[model samples]
Target: MPQPSKLHTRFVRQLLPLLVLAFVLSAASTTWFTHRSQLAQAQVQRSQTLVTLGAALVKPLWDCDGTTIQAVVQAMTDQPNVRSVLVQDQCNATTWQAGTQAQGPDLHTLTIPLLYYASTGRSYSVGALTITFTGVSVRTSLTHNVGLQLVVFATMLAAVLTGAAWVFRRIIGRPLHRLREAMRAHQELTPIPAHWAEELAEITATYNTQVQELRRQARHDPLTGLGNRTLLEEHLQRAIRRAERTRALGHVLLLDLDRFKPVNDTYGHAAGDAVLKTVAQRLLSCVRDTDTVARLGGDEFVVLTPDAPVEGSIQALAQRLRNAIEQPIDWNGRALQVRASIGVAQLLRDGTTSAALLASADAAMYAHKQQDR
Candidate 1:
């Protein structure tokens, strides 16, 4: 099966016919207008030519000078549109005429009155001049003008189509293509660059935010807002590598809350949740910023110090953690208290890997809890 077409391709395909139709309508309207204008211009030109020629022929027609009248009529009839010219005296008899009869059926005739002024300051009608104009000249001019205008319209239409394609690709197609590729590759965030366009920017931002939230939820405990076992293992592995490289002493502490199940059994899980939140905050306050605190599960917590200094001993750190857990948590006007049993394991001395270290710390933590019992 063939692959589906892209968005821009589809858009162009859908819009092409409409653009072509519009071009055809525009060309037709322009040609019609040009034809009308050419006809009107021909009429104006014929009127002007007749007025000028009649003024020159007034004296000749009055004196019956056949030579001058014939010369003037022949001159005006020589024009391309003037098919024939006729001059008639006051008796309606032809004084002089030039050219043949109308060649085409479409023809126009205009007659102008020739007046002469005598020595007595009185003017009288001498004769009339009639000229016949052919429509062939106007038709030829309309055809040439319409052809030229069609070429111009075609050029402009091509330019508009090219510009439309460019705009669609830049503004709509590129961003969506990038988004499709990233999604296919299982990307965590959108890879599209800034300053491109706002069409898909909001969608990319929303997807990236959701991805970050999913990552955070995967590696953190929802109840206590502390690192989960997955995150703790990652931190431990990194700390183990650092300790092995620097040849420094590091410590891991495993802690278990004493009598924690009784609180959950008595006051319900809500009270137990409050107690766990309080414990998490106290653990954070007790440990250094360089230390990692994680909740492995119900009432079980672990702390990893990647770089334990010589001044701070493992026993002191464990004691501090134990004391912090022993503090009272306020819940509904009641002070709930619990004790913690912590076990310490020195990196490189007890175990090397995260699993081994955690096992060692767990065994020690159980032994200490039994002693408290």
Candidate 2:
């Protein structure tokens, strides 16, 4: 059976890839928006700056002052990312031009016209200024900003996942581990403390109910309410391992109820069931609390003594069991008497394995029945 913590861990592992994908998509969206906004702002700022520079050249251009126009054009071209500047007269004549033409398609261009007014208040275009901006510096800065944002986003994502893992461990994983331990120890199923998620509580309740039912059916015999053959084998194996470690003796006793078929033949299965229940109670009273008594099948039972006494004391124990089985049982005001033939096998003497020891005891039981015959 898998522990609850392991299941929780597995669930988290399955969710991690989705979480990372979400983070990546969110980051991509953020980067795209930020880049576009930065580019838009840079274009606006560059346009405004060029308009101001163009306004400064209006007076110098209208006067047709060559030195002042050249000085103004040189200042505009010297500004960072200013690729080219052109000034054209009202007659569509190029008067002043500086810097090379823009190299690539990635450029921001702005055009501003200079208006000259006559004494009659009519305005006519005297010249126009055209400026082209290269986007190389802007793109470089954007690249740097994107790198920084990636680092920040990655760090935040790590911290968020780490916190989530810790919360899951404390709230879900630990509770599941406790539940698993309780189940393994065969303790009463207690309701786990409520979690923040109602669904988790419902799932836990359902799981606990199913596990309890399964354990009950697996380990117990329905008829006598005693340990079943599966439980017997488990207890037998544990007893053998403990005996080997401690160098102590253990015993397995396989018993067959003598003349049990006659009871079924005389009074039917109901009367035989009563006899079996009564015999099971009697067997319980014959041994210590540490020992285990199991029903293997019809008319057959086994007892496991984890710490058996010496040979004489062990024989006495077996004799007591036989006497208990021979005692008369009253079922529905009718008295029923039965006898048991028991076979004995000792740990390290008969065999080490549960299968070997059970076989030896089975063979001894047939031998005892033959002697009685």
Candidate 3:
């Protein structure tokens, strides 16, 4: 029996980590790009506002218009991204300042020189205007949208992964699981459903083929391809039950090779194996389709005939098996021959049980061998 496959378990274990990593990567990438774009846009807007405010104050400063200068500065302070605004005199000293302190977290300072243009196209520096822009404003706005984006991404990822998991289980995981269970239970596995995908169908087909081959190897003789003792016993038990039910006579014929050791000792085990295979083929030919032919290890064989007619039929069957075994076999351009001594035991006459019938047949076969000696 084969052990269960961990296809689903291993797939989940591996897929989950990869999906989490992908989600993390996607989220980070989206957030990073969004933040950078928003920050750049914010920087541009702040630059434009600073230039416009500087233009508005140039005339007020040049004419020494204190009321206008204060009014313009106050309006600039009221804008949301601007933390503070300050005006400096020609000496670079702060003349007027509004809003919070110039120094603060997530704030940037920009200074522009005030120039007075004359009729001759000559410019003179009047003073400078300094404005502090709050960098946190862009990030603050991003926070809400980022949350929504993350939620959307998460939902999409979950749906995709769920579909993928279902597809994987339907095509690969479930079929492999079924095959594993059938193998573990030592049961004949039905072929995978035709509706399954081609790859899974191919896999199950290959699996079933190998399983059948393994079963054949287990119950059969490797050399002769005949049913081995295990298979023989199984058939024998069934035959015994059937005979008991029908109240019919059955026969067990045990055949042991005479002069088989000489063939092995003189010609090596290879020739002896060839002789055995040939004999197995011969034995199969001599029996009816309902009968069973099995090899019980080296140079020994058993033929089971259930619902046999009479004593004469058993004798005729035994003679036919002996004749088949005595035929010349061609191996390696050499003719090799062997003989079999067959002993028959009648079911319900010699013994009722499989063990008893086999025992009786085995004993009778040895007696036949002794008589030939």
Number of the predicted model whose TM-score against the real structure is largest: 3
lDDT of 1 by residue, 1-373 (tens): 9999977788878888887787677767776777688778888888898888889899878788778877988898888778899888764366678887765557888898888888999989988889888873545655776677678768876887799889878877777787777667757554657866775888887777777887788889999999999999999999899888997788899999997888888888899999999999999988888889999999999989997744567888888888888888888887888889888888988899998999999999999988988
Give the runs in model 3 whose Cα sits over 4 Å from its true position.
1-13, 39-65, 86-97, 100-132, 136-173, 195-203, 309-312, 330-335, 366-373
| lDDT score, candidate 2, position 52 | 89
What 10-residue stretch in candidate 2 is worst by lDDT?
136-145
Please give, for residues 184-280, the per-residue lDDT of candidate 3 as tens digits. Answer: 9876567568878788677778778888898899999999999998899899888888888897778899999988898899899999988998898
Superposed Cα deviation of residue 363, candidate 3 (Å) = 4.0
lDDT of 2 by residue, 301-320 (tens): 99999986544677898899
Winner on TM-score between 1 and 3 is 3
| Candidates ranked, most accurate by TM-score first | 3, 1, 2
When summed lDDT is taken over every stretch of 10 residues in candidate 3, the lowest stretch is: 136-145
Each prediction's TM-score against the native? 0.73, 0.56, 0.74
lDDT of 1: 0.84
Every model's Cα RMSD, please?
5.0, 9.1, 5.3
